[model samples]
Target: MDTTTHVAQTERRRTSPPAGSAGPSAGADPRRGPKRLSPRMRKLTLLIHVIAAVSWLGLDVGLLTLSVTGRISDDPETIRAAYVAMDVFGDVLLIPVALFTLVTGVLLGMGTRWGLLRYHWVLTKLVLTLVAFTATVAALRPGLEQAARDALRTPPEVGAAASDVLVAPCVALALYTFMTVLSVYKPWGMTRFARERLGRPGAHGAARGK
Candidate 1:
């Protein structure tokens, strides 16, 4: 071939995308994201996440009940017992619930059409769960320890300002309840990321054609 023809061919090869990437959207884009999970794996993850969430809520209810009982009961022994139980449950049950729920939900999101940032509701839930987890670690567990220690003191009486031992659990219950409702309703519209992908020209139509 002539020098001119050779130069033109090289330019075309360099400019054109590699084979199998000529469509509207290519996998090379970071935003294109990862592939979804199989239906079986998705269902399994959802089941685990649901169980962890419900268990967390139930444990919080137990803590709340103990708190109320300790607050109303005049007996120091009852109060001490309640605080100790709270400590044990918090350590043994609540921590695992929080960690498992967070991990499973993240996996579920990544492995489904609901990319973590794709929907407003999903994003909100992720934020709330993270916040709840942070509170569990930074404040809730430590506060439980403090309350347990205070209850074990010489007098064995609940402290005058021991309301937190009662209040934190109640707040956690409410927070978890809200999260559950969000999961059910999923009311919010698509997030910016989802809109961009599922928007104009119907690029995602094939993948989401169900």
Candidate 2:
């Protein structure tokens, strides 16, 4: 009886999984794993992001020009045309563009190896983007509307505002490139990520590796 028990226990031990082996289909869990990004999907996402950003800049230019010009003919018809363009552009171009950029940006940040919390540039852009979004929705739109209203009624010199408008894209483009640099170079000044996973390594480790 004792010999039989020992043999049975040895057989069971032999049949058991090795250390760190996840049984039959090791590391095959549906959860806690990565979903692969198809190349077409990536290209489409990039197209949408770039196009939408360009549209936002272009649409702003149109509206800015119309609002700034004092001699745009205050005939109800002309004003209606201006407002119509503004409304159409805002409803169609602006909202969708901004939404796509924000959504895609978030996905690109989190769904990749970087996981959003790792990189310094992505981290900085994350902060800057919040401010930019707030400014666009909470401040820029209102400011533009008030400026338009004032432009319609009073003959004020808003060359300063218009000048900013012309330069805004350049500033934004520069800042965006700066964000990209932060993503690429990842020069560290702030507190580290509680690990040495800055820039791409953080992303890579989070996505790949054991």
For model 2, how does the per-residue alpha-carbon lDDT over 1-210 read when each residue is reduced to its tens digit?
Answer: 699999999999999987887764865632222434466776676677677656665766676655444334546445544544554555456656666666777766666544456555667777776665665666545444544444444343334443443344355556556765675586653325524433333644555444
Per-residue error for 134 in candidate 1, Å, reads 0.3
Residue lDDT tens for model 1, 1-210: 999999999999998888976544643544445668888998898899999998988888998898888778878899889989999998899889999999999999899766799878889999999999998988888888888888888777576435876888878888888888888898765666676765544535644675
Candidate lDDT values, in order: 0.82, 0.56
| Residue 41 displacement in candidate 1 (angstroms) | 1.1
Best by TM-score: 1
Q: Which ten residues in a row have the lowest lDDT in candidate 1?
A: 23-32
Give model 1's clash tally: 0
TM-scores of all candidate predictions against the true structure = 0.77, 0.55
Looking at candidate 1, what is the lDDT of residue 72?
87
